[model samples]
Target chain A: MASLLKKLGSFAAGATLLFAASAALAKPLTVGFAQTGAESAWRTANTNSMKSEAEKRGINLKFADGQGKQENQIRAVRTFVTQGVDAIVLAPIVETGWEPVLREAKRAKIPVVIMDRKVQTSDESLYACFIGSDFYKEGAMAAEWIAKNAGSRSKIVELQGTPGSAAANERRKAFADELAKNPALKIIDSQSGDFRRSGGKEVMEAFLKKHGKDIEIVYAHNDDMALGAIQAIEEAGLKPGKDILIVSIDAIKEGVQAVVDGKINAVVECNPLFGPKIYDTIAKIKAGEPVERSSYNVDIVIDSTNAAALIGQRQY
Target chain B: MSKSKSLSPVWWPLIGLAVLVAVNLALNPAFLNVTVLDGRLYGLPIDILNQGARGLVLALGMTLVIATGGVDLSVGSVMAAAGALAAVLLAEGHGLAVALTAGLGVGLLAGAANGLLVARFGIQPIVATLILMVVGRGAAQLMTNGEVVVIKNDAFAFVGNGTVFGFPFAPLLAIALFVAAQLFLRRTASGLFIEAVGDNETAARFAGLGAARVKGLVYVICGLCAGLAGLMAAANIRAADSYRMGENMELDAIFAVVVGGTALTGGRFLLLGSFIGALLLQTLTTTMYNLGVPPAVAPVPKAVLILVVCLLQSEHARRWAVSLVKGGKK
Candidate 1:
């Protein structure tokens, strides 16, 4: 009877321990986020979005800042793998050189989700999904807006971003392609502003001197360059929004503000807030559901009509 | 021969500038056209001067530094740091005077640190300045939290955008500083001391020329010039971008100094040559823009043009070319 009573006690204790272990397992999901450093205002906003979203969802997050280095990001990934994170989110700084580390994550079955920039790999299985803004579409949207709004014979001067960068290449190609549909809207001159305000100002000053009032439209890859061009235009004794219709991408706070001020005609939004969408995608992946290999966040066009109301919503 | 001798030091850069200007004019007949609007000069020529102002100031300091057989790789970074400090100060509601002084002070302090490292500790100038080059940008980024600090003060902006007698203030300030420095250096024993130390530090020291002190002093002056350039760049944009402010400007400054006929090996220096060199480079950039050269292909032509000018600047290359032409004619 005594031996039987002892066995019953042991079974009860073992059953309680199993129940506690199951409860712990169902507590909350833990995720590891590998960010590509706070390099710019856009990047800072992206990071904040992710962090705040994680907090709102009650996920245990392990954050790692790569500090603009690929090696550091790789190390962070390895650490996440070792920690046995439920999911891993990576914002790669470059496209290539991510396959090996990603292969390791795949082996761990951590479900890596790429954000903002892209990763070039033959095996798409290495990453669960990629969520980023479509640079080409953004450029096309800007061009489409111009074709509809500006006169058919409008002469456009394009201020490109840094040479050979992904954003610059795609934006330039798409804008040119879209503008090709409307041959009358000719790009009179295009130059690389190196995606810098100073570059934009200098190039705009030259363009103003060379082309003068002949340029009716200034299409810049990014808003910083647009702002710089606005300064150049103002300095040249011409009203920016009145004399030249300006269209640009990346509706950063300053860019949106410029639209609100009526200095810039329109700005295409390249939304940096990826937190909510990323979490939704992760949830689908967690539920053992099929997910798209690559998904683009739909961008919006912000003009004077919506700019003022949207300005307060801009976090970056 | 007399004409060639008179133009020997700065003639090549001048020719390059003239050629580029001629090319721009060829591309567009209106390239040289200047008009006044709102009491300010508006033209490609004025644009070149205004845009080249930062590089001109940097070259001014770099010329002196190179004359002493040293190069300050930190000028660009110092520009970023000083501009960041000034922008941050103004953003926080500080007076323009305080902001300007603080910005200039950062340059002086950074220069003094570099001087101490090189002169006092006997570190190589390149390595010593390299330390600041690496740290200065980081410091600037830290101060601005890696975000651009937008400045909204018109008084400060005037330094970069405002014109005096229809000329951009930045270029005018640069020219005025160049003139004053030229007079001061050429009219005093200070220039002799710098040359002596640069030529032979041991000989200058043995002759009681205070070689170390001269070496230290040049860095300070360079720092001050870079600081002012930083302020001008920030004011022009009305924002301090710690990341891109003065990026690669040290290289431009060095190129300007070298193109201006200053030997990297030390001793001989040309202040006016650097000024023209800076203008020539700016003209090349403007020419590219005026011609609308595709961004990817622009660098190739720019490189070729710089190579030709550099080759022409070489006495040996010119003599060899002349001899080759003579032989071919025969």
Candidate 2:
């Protein structure tokens, strides 16, 4: 009887110790983040959002800048896995060459949350969830606005993004697909601007010379290109918003201001603020709660009505 | 025979330009149409000149550098840094004069550095300029803090977008510079000196030519040209995008120099050929847009066209083609 009681007491002590150790491990909720380099305004804003949000939530964040290289990013992920953080966040620079490093993370039993750009892997189970903006939705939203504002038989010209880029291809595809529903509305001309202001201006100038006054609407894949088209339109002695309806995506600070000034008629937001959504998903993962495989931050369409109010609030 | 050969090479780019224009016209009847809008020219032709102005200016400097048997890979980066400095200055409420001078000064300094590396330190031109090519953009990014710095000054904008007597200022500036440079090269002994140094630097040095000084000066001139091009690019957009400004422009400038019949191995250079070459490239881009060619397949056609032009310019290729034709006839 005495030996049995001693055995029960030791088992109770071991159980208590295990529980205390787990509590200690779960308290800080450290997360490792591998970021794409601060190559642009949007990317910088995304980085700032991640940092500020982590501070607000009292979560420990380990940040690594990939400096626009996939090798550096893979090295960062390896470091994160070795560190044994509770979760890992990756803003992949490219889509492939991630399987091996990701497999290492999987072996370590760490959940990875992919942010802005996605990684391609046959094993979907490698990542816990993907948190990114829906580029297709942003394009569809812009096209929907065009369909509503543009009357029947409106001829449109599209300024595409960099060729073969996910954002460019998906945005162009979705816009075309959505606009296909309306038979009368047609894209008279489409060309890649390489997602640049100068390219946009040059291409728009050619489109104007080719199509002339027949072009009724201009849809640009991004704000920079739209801004360039605005210059081209003005140079042609035609009012941008008044003469040709302009629809653009990314709703950047300049894009929003252009909307308020009545240059761009519509801007579909591709929110770079992934902080709140990222943390919410992380919290769920920590609590053994079910989370969706992929979730996109909600984006809104900005026009004359809300552009004035929102222009001042744009961080990027 | 050498003079004839040299002269014939220059005509190839001009011929290429004519051919591209014809192709554009065939595809779009309005390809050559120019209309007066707000007293300024608005047409694909004008657009080509305006858009090609940056390349033209860069190619001018590149041609000189190439003539000296050196390449300025840093010109693109110099453009970025100079534009960033000017944009930041103008954004901070500085006058256009201050901004422009400072921008040009940055170019001169960057060129001097590259010249120092190549001439003073005896480093390879490719390796020396590659240092700036990598770091220059980073420095620009640092200045702009990774954001596109927008400028609102009309005077500054005028440098890029303004028109003089219905002609764009950028192209005019480019042409004026070209004419002046061409005159200076032709009228003085400096052109011969540059050619002598390029053909054989050791032999030129032995012959009492200031080879290093000539090399250093070309780099400075190239830097200045790139600086002007950078400012024009920034002014054109009314903003300074550090990341995107002057990206891959070195390759374009080199392409222009090569296409203009300037031998990459150095010694011989043609300014007019480069001018036409730059225009030819811009015409090709505009032609692609006018045709509404999908971006995915665009590069293939562009590559094929470039190959054809290059083949036509090559004596060996022309000879081979002639032989193949004769053999087929037999």
Query: Weakest 10 consecutive residues, lDDT, candidate 1 chain B?
Result: B1-10
Best by DockQ: 2
Model 2 CA lDDT for position A94? 94
Residue A75 in candidate 2 has what lDDT? 99
Q: Write the per-residue lDDT of candidate 1 for residues B69-113, one digit (tens) a residue.
A: 999999999999999999999999999999999999989998898
Could you give the CAPRI-style class of model 2?
A: medium
Docking class of 1: medium
Pairs that collide, model 2: none
Query: Residue-wise lDDT of candidate 1 within A155-177, one digit each (tens)?
Result: 99999999999999999999999
TM-score of chain B taken alone, candidate 1: 0.98
Clashes of each: 0, 0
**Alpha carbon lDDT of residue A167, candidate 1?**
92
| lDDT string, candidate 2, A207-295, tens digits | 88888889899999999999999999998889999999999999899999999999999999989999999999999988899999988
Off by over 4 Å in 1: A1-27, B1-7
